[model samples]
Target: MTIKLIAIGKTDDKELVKLIENYQKRLSHYIQFEFEIIPDLKKAKNLSESQQKQKEGDLILGKLNPSDVLILLDENGKQFDSVAFSQYLQKHMNSGIKQLVFVIGGPYGFSEDVYSRANGKLSLSKMTFSHQMIRLFAIEQLYRAFTILRNEPYHHR
Candidate 1:
């Protein structure tokens, strides 16, 4: 199955960008993968948090195809170890899922509309992470998940 990661905003940190690229390259070795970024909203200073989420949600929803299984990276979502996450990936692949889409929402998180579109939610940690940092973490974890699936030496326990 193809896996796609969609996130809001750009990463300005050169180190983080480099690491994200590294993981993306490693991930491509295991699955059909793509990373798409939604540019941060313009004039966001004037919009209320709810308004911002609504506007961003529109763009987020627009990027999706009806058949894609969307998983949101949310603070209140399920938490899993790398091994479990790899098994999760394996289960979906075995189920004949086409494209597995994972989204990292903008500041103030996803709107109600965006929540409605998701098939599930995953939490990387209880601690909050910057959207840019989350991008790196998400991709790295995805790479690790595939490695664990293949019994590679990248992950222990």
Candidate 2:
């Protein structure tokens, strides 16, 4: 199955971009991975938080295919340790799906519409993280999950 990560806005920090790229390269060895950045909304300052989320949600939804399995990285979602997360990845891979899509929403988080359409929600941590930082964290974890599944030395229990 192809794994795709869709995040709102671009990473302005060069260092973070490099780190994300490194993990992306490593992930390519195990599975098909795609990273897509939805452009930041123009005149966002003029919109209310809810409105922004709606707009971002629309853009996110537009990128998804009907067959894609959608998962949202949300603060209130189920939390799993690395080993469990690896199992989660394995479960999806074994399901014979075409694509697994995980989305990192904008500042205000996902809209009601987005939440309604999601197949599942996952939390990386209870602690809050910047959207840009979360992109890096998600990719690294995905890479680690694949390595663990393959019994590679990259992930230490």
lDDT of 2: 0.97
lDDT for predicted candidate 1 compared with the true structure: 0.94
Q: What lDDT would each prediction earn against the true structure?
A: 0.94, 0.97
Q: Would you list the clashing residue pairs of candidate 2?
A: none
> Taking the tens digit of each residue's C-alpha lDDT, what string does model 1 give over 1-157?
8999999998989999999999999999999999999999999999999999999999999999999999999999999988899899999999898999999999899999989989999999999989999999999999999888888888874
Residue 62 lDDT (model 2) = 99
How far off is model 1, as Cα RMSD?
1.0
Residue 155 of model 1: what lDDT? 87
On the 0 to 100 scale, the lDDT of residue 108 in model 1 is 94
C-alpha RMSD between model 2 and the true structure = 0.8
Candidate 1 colliding pairs: none
Which regions of candidate 1 are displaced past 4 Å? none
